[model samples]
Target: MAVERNIKCVVAYDGTKYQGWQRLKNSDHTIQGKIEHVLSKMTNEKIEVMGSGRTDAGVHARWQVFNFHTRCQKSTKNMMDYMNQYLPEDIGVCQVEDVDLRFHSRFHAKKKTYIYRIWIGEYPPVFERKYVHVVTETLHLQKMKEAALLFIGEHDFQGFCSRKVKKSTVRKINHVQLKQEGHELTISVTGNGFLYNMVRIMVGTLIDIGKGTLTKETITEALDTKDRSKAGERAPAKGLILHDVSY
Candidate 1:
């Protein structure tokens, strides 16, 4: 029997055209599906790759990680080249390596960092409209920063999540950093794990707080009451990016 080797890969993709990261049964319009198609062609086997996590539709990823087991004899470098050659131009393979057979990308991930970019420029972001959320209102960074502090550390993030959780809603947020440069405002968050739409909802709440529509007390209310309605609107998916995943 040919030995099956675990192959790990890092990929970056513009998720504008794809549905999401996870593969769907009826549809092939996903990042995972596209890569799997190319990989299967190369290996001559039906391959299923395990992703570190899913990114929602219209959400981009700069350093998404996934792993799969394959019996193909190609070197890691050749596999990477083959994937890039066949995969859509929107998706790019950054690295490929042979890893331990037991290595599972999703379970092995220890931390993930996500970044949401907002443009507060006077004019619309004509050059980068697809990549950022453009906001015309003045956003008070100080207020947003103060409100952001409330999210750090462990908490039952049920209120921040948009979906009902069958599992525990508790998640640990390591840090929330906000930076502004000219017309750009970036909200970067590092967390152990996140509930569905948690980061986007948090960003939306922060934006509302900055605009004086919501107060810092709103975060406390969400944490204390576990009411999703207490949180702000979920931010648009275009602004969100999976920045990195660390094992």
Candidate 2:
């Protein structure tokens, strides 16, 4: 009898066309569903791939970690090659390894970094339109930086999350870095875990601050009151990318 093995894989995808990362009952156009379909055929068993977390529709991922258990004896290299050969062109398998049976992709994840790109140029970024959010308003980067700093510590971000859940809304953010190069404004957030739409809301609030539409005190009030209405609107999903996942 073949031993069951935990197969870990890192994947990247241009999620422009898919219905997010999680599998759905009615839709076949999902990143997880596509990968799982290929794996099930490769392993000759019902394979269910577990992702580190779910990314909403139209959100891209540069590095997403996932794992599945299988009894197939194919080598890791062969498995990676087989998956890439069958998976769609938009989704690429970056790395594959045989992990311990106890290891889990979502449960063992220590940190995740998401990058939200904004184009603050006067002209349209034709080449990067799908990857960036174009903003025409005059933005104050210094003000945005000051507002981003307030999100570094742990807080009950009930105001930032759009979905109401029974779980605790308190989460610790390791860092929030904002960098501007020419017309590109990149906001990178590193956190242990994120709530639904939390990152987008944080970025949106910063953009509001940059435009002088919202004051920095809004962050304090939002954190204190845990009111969703206190935060800014959720940013577009296209601008958000799952940049990296750390074990």
Candidate 3:
């Protein structure tokens, strides 16, 4: 029997040109699809890469992890080099290593961190327009900080999720840290797991608090009622990035 080598890689992508991470029959312009295409071409065989989770279209990723099994005997360094050479400029393999066959990127991940960047200055971010979401509205940073605390701890985040979901909505958030550097408001969330659009909705609700549109109590109401309409608007995907993932 031929041996199957399991390889894991850390990838960084702009996500501006691709449809998303997951491969779909409806569209072939996905991050996963693109990676598979390059790797398959080099290995002269079909390859399927599995990611930790699917990020929405236009969402950037700093360090996304994926795994795939191939019979090719190339060294890890060679594979990584070939990947960077063949993949598009927007997508790059930062690191690659061989792992046990049992290593599953999605199931083995312990925590994931996502950062949402909001540009608050009057002058729109010309260079970072595709990377950050520009909002000119005046924001009360102190009030937003207080509202962000509501997302900590475990809860049924039904209201925070916008996508139609069949799985349980219960997830635990370790912390939501907000920082301001110059005109950029960076919201970072570290969680055990997140439902679809959970972090974005939470950030949206915090923006509401900054604008004095929603009180801190609104978050409690949304969680208790389990109604999506009660939650704040979902932020744009362009502002969100998969900052990191830990196993």
In order of appearance, the predictions have TM-scores of 0.99, 0.99, 0.97
Candidate 2 vs candidate 3, lDDT winner: 2
C-alpha lDDT values of all predictions: 0.95, 0.95, 0.91
> Residue 10 lDDT in model 3?
97
Q: On a 0 to 100 scale, what is the lDDT of residue 213 in model 3?
A: 89
Residues 10-111, candidate 2: write the lDDT tens digits: 999999999999999999999999999999999899999999999999999999999999999999999999999999999999999999999999999999
Error of 1 at 33 (Å): 0.7
- lDDT tens digits by residue: candidate 3, 1-247: 4689999999999988888898989897899999999999988889999899988888889999999999999999999999999888999999999999999999999999999999998898988899898888899999999988988999999899987678889999998999999989999999998888888999999888888888888898999998888888888889999999999
RMSD of each: 0.7, 0.7, 1.1
Q: Tens digits of per-residue lDDT for model 1 on 1-247?
A: 7898999999999999989999999988999999999999999999999999999989999999999999998999999999999999999999999999999999999999999999996899988798899999999999999999999999999999999989999999999999999899999999999888998999999999999999999999999899999999999999999999999
Report lDDT (Cα) of residue 141, candidate 2: 94
lDDT of 3 at 62: 95
Error of 3 at 176 (Å): 0.2
- Weakest lDDT window of 10 consecutive positions for candidate 1: 121-130
Model 3 residue runs over 4 Å out of place are none
Alpha carbon lDDT of residue 148, candidate 2? Answer: 89
